[model samples]
Target: MTAQKKCPVCGKPAEIEFRPFCSKRCADVDLGRWFNESYVVPEPIDPETVIADDGEGDETIH
Candidate 1:
């Protein structure tokens, strides 16, 4: 038998309609977290690899 997945918010068995979450409440809670910036997706940037324009009216950067 396959195991049921629990809701990430409430630890309850997930419903088919909600898939990963147990209900609309849990789903809304997750969405609220995103809107409130509780979750963040990070992008890393390297300064040495960055290109800066020298204002020579050219597309190439030094």
Candidate 2:
């Protein structure tokens, strides 16, 4: 049998609707961590890769 996926936050069995998270609460908690800057990328941002948006160009980053 395949092992069930667990939620990253609470170690609960992940649901299909929530994928990696067990419930909406867990998903919200993850989102809150991101919003609160509790989670972060370890790599430092490279200044050469950044684009300055002066609103003078039509190129959207996303």
Q: What stretches of model 1 exceed 4 Å from their correct place?
A: 38-62
Q: State the weakest 10-residue window (summed lDDT) of model 2.
A: 52-61
* lDDT by residue (tens digit), candidate 2, 1-62: 75789999899999989978999999999989888785566677877667665678765656
Q: Distance (Å) between predicted and true CA of 4, model 1?
A: 0.5
| Model 1 lDDT, residue 28, Cα | 97
In model 2, what is the error at residue 43, expressed in angstroms? 15
* Per-model TM against the reference: 0.56, 0.55
Question: Judged by lDDT, which candidate is best?
Answer: 2
Stretches of model 2 off by over 4 angstroms after superposition: 1-3, 38-62
Q: Write the per-residue lDDT of candidate 1 for residues 16-57, one digit (tens) a residue.
A: 899799999999998898887844546556675565546558
lDDT (Cα atoms) of all candidates against the true structure: 0.83, 0.85
